[model samples]
Target chain A: MDAIETNSLGRRFGDVNAVESLDLTVQKGEIYGFLGPNGAGKSTTINMLLGFTPPSSGSGTVLGYDLEHESVAIRQSVGVLPEDFGVYGRLTARKHVRFAIETKGADDDPDDLLGRVELADVADRTAGGFSTGMKQRLALAMALAGNPDLLILDEPSSGLDPNGAREMRAIIREENERGTTVFFSSHVMEQVEAICDRVGIMRDGRLIAEDAIDSLKDRFDADSRLVFTLDTVADDIVPALETMNGVTDINADGNDVSVVVADASRKAPVIEAVGASGVTIKDIRIDDSSLEDLFATLTTGERPTSRHAEENAANTTQLIREADQ
Target chain B: MSWVHVARKDFADALRSKLLWVLSALMILVVAGISAIPQLLYIPGQGPAPGFDDGMSFMFTWMTMMVSIIGLVVGYRAIVGERESGSIRFLLGLPNSRRDVVVGKVLGRATVVAVPTVIGFLVGAVVILALYDGFAVTDYIGLLVFALVIGLVYVSVAVAVSASVNTRAKAVGGVLGIYLIFDLLWWTVPMAIYWLLERELPGSTDLPAWYVLVERLGIWEPLGILSGTLVDIAGVETVSTADRLAGDVPFFLETWFAWVIVIAWVAIPLGIGYYRFNRAVMS
Candidate 1:
């Protein structure tokens, strides 16, 4: 059975539809990425999942327990790192970790959890005086106290620098490797692609796309950026490139035109055609589609336009809007 | 219980902060200074009238005010400060119930407030004995109970205020406003209204019916309990101990409805505060 199944879940705040029809299925031990831009209702969805608030409509089951009837159970079983900094500033790092462990009724040692987060050196220091990254690390340590079967982290790397972010990612991966189901929400596409086994893209409180990262990459055809430096201005080059097979769009500026294509392998043929037109190519580069490209494409309501995801995002957004009413 | 852990942690954290010790010392010095009034202002064994108890009256008036001030300051931050510091979230996020959180907080802070007030009262008692003639055992018991109950009711009211407001500033403002309003209403309003009515109606009329309701309203006020207990200790004829402890009648029915109201004042809001706590959304 899936560790989490949120079916048609929706939430609205006053006139604002914060989350809508967010159907997600995260299997056991799978690192699921909840990708969305800021204000995409990522935090709201996580809040509902953790039973911090009730859903506006729809239903979900977490860890085989009914979301409606067993919310407290779900909260008990799942570990969370809320988007908001939930650590107490006045308390020492050890105190905070110990508090969390005791709250979870887990017999885990506070020193061990602090050690795992690499915060043992500063365990005696007040969290209030700690750096943002240190606080984030402390929050992570607190969340890891119970060895929860399911972990919901909302932008766990938000305040972390590159190294801190890398360490957080490693901790998440290690947790996942230990058979903990990881549900992480992030606007950073590279991190999502690097850490998550599967990805779900949300836009305007809707899950517009969901699939394995590679599969999403394929479905969106999020590959092929045409990079060619031109020797001189070429008239009708854009028109010609637009007419080519598998070419999506061509960006033409003063001295260069970068064409986006469906596949990177089609670059040589396009280069040959451009060269054949007696246009001197000073240099050329081919850029493949990345998670960043996929995120930008999905959030803009562009890439999923011709696929099933466009309708999915639309329907989810509609459901959220209606719930607000 | 988890509340013990929460209480221990709150106490430990409070003890570690030097500000608490500073505040406690300041409170003791100020209260002790105020306790010196009988010696400094009043003539010994004499007043306008020959038999009037000026010392008891002065002690009741000054000590009640001092204890009330202490209760207000110590209890004001119970909820709002915790919420602002994000510490409440850490406490609430645990497996414990909201009742545990609220109860533990109130109980913990009550311990903090009680220590100074009790010590201050004991030190003041010694000063009264040294400087002037001290009271009987009943007076000491009455003053102790009065101080504790006044502190508790104020703390409970403060907790209710804390739960209602979102910020520490608002909470302090709210509790201070409540204290001022209650002080004026319970002490001044009934007498003010009575004095006004006595002028219009002469000897022919009674105190207005609203005055009776307002007098009853005073029973629900914490300051009223403090004054009522003080009066009982200082030999005012409000209610007798025999009437209060009478077992033949149902306890609630036997007492001056004022004591019942005071008990409810302490219990009811505390119940609601705990309920609010359970339902409160912590980050």
Candidate 2:
């Protein structure tokens, strides 16, 4: 069964449709990255799934339990690290996790959970005086209680430094390896791109794109920009490489040449042909299209709330394709 | 049963905040410290040399008042504070139902008020025994139970208010309004009504039964009425309800039925609170 499934799920706040006809599915044992710009309804969807907010329309299930009728059971099985969650300031960190374990009727040791989040030493310290990063870790430790089958984390790395965020990612990966289905929401593209097996992008309360990262990149017609430094430049280098396979575009300037290839598989052929052309290849640096750029393409209204950038990027790719023809 | 965990956690957290200690101190002052005032008033040669009855009558009045206020203070922030600080995410994020939250908070806050109350009465017993002569142990225990029941009543009302509203400001206003209208000024409610209908203020003798019944609906009125049943301290509220009635008293107005009113005071508010809380859409 899918870890989480929502069909035609929607929520409306007053006149605004906060989440409109959202059909989201996260398969078991996969890290599904929920991506959206701010106010894009990602959090709203999470709230509905967790029964924090009732949906205006449609139905859903988490781990075979109905979202509306069986919410308590859903929560019993799913571990949630909610966004904007606050800790009990007067209670110690270990107390927080132990409370969760008790509430869920789980047998996990509180100290072990604290150790996982690197909060073992501070377990006796009150959460009220903890730093933001420490509070986030404590919340994560609580979420790790009970060895839940599915973990729903909203912006899990939001308050952490880069190193802390990396630690969080490692823990999430470790949990997933333990046969746990991880569904986490984030606006940060790099972390999602690095860790998620598949991603579903939301925009204006609707799902616009859902695919594996490489496929999503490919769908945008993102050509890989390979920058190579040559020991010596051949006089006819540009003309000779122009007719090669999968070379979308090539720019030559002195001893540095950059080739935009249509796919990753074409990089090997282009490199072999370039070596045969009598130019010594000094270094190769490949830059695939980042998720930030893909998001800028998919949700072009992300900045300044306009759609012009999306059309421009599409037109640039079309121009390159026509030139190849 | 899961509410047990919620209650335990709430008590532990609030206990560590030192609020319980502060409450314990206040209760001691009200019960033990205030009970000694009657002894001080005794001039040694004038009047009945202020014995145990004097201390019991003097201290029970203050104990009731303090318990009511303390209960409200301890409970008003129980649920709303969590919502405001966003700790409710951890609360509801677990398998906890909203019923569990409301029920657990009431029990937890009730214990907060009860622990100190028990301590205060224990300490006050020693002081009352040493300072006075007619030390009736049953009367003192009766008053102690009365104080604890009053604490539960007010805590239920405060937690109900906390559950009904979404903000701390509203919770404060709710409890305050309830205190002033239904509790402190409850005497005026029936008096004003009697004047409006009967063209005069309600007198202490041969009064309308409806006026007394309206008074019984208040938070303190039923408790006050039941105090007669709970204890018979010599100098405290010696005039019984039957003495002031116009005719043969209705069965419901009897001292025993006041137990029904007290139970309603605790039950009805909690029922309403749980209903409102269960339907709340956590944002």
In candidate 1, position A7 carries an lDDT of: 88
lDDT of 2 at B224: 87
lDDT of 2 by residue, A270-321 (tens): 8888888887889987766555766665554433233233322442444334
Per-residue lDDT of B131-222 in model 1, one digit per residue for the tens? 55534657666666776777777677777777666788987898878777665456576666767867543222343345444555552343
List the lowest-lDDT window of 10 residues for candidate 2 chain B: B232-241
**Best candidate, lDDT:** 2
Q: Could you tally the backbone clashes for each prediction? A: 0, 1
Candidate 2 C-alpha error for residue B98, in Å: 0.4
lDDT of each candidate versus the true structure: 0.70, 0.85
TM-score, structure 1 vs. true: 0.79
Docking class of 2: medium
Task: Give candidate 1 misplaced runs (Cα > 4 Å).
Answer: A64-71, A218-222, A227-260, A263-284, A300-325, B30-57, B125-139, B186-210, B219-232, B235-256, B267-283
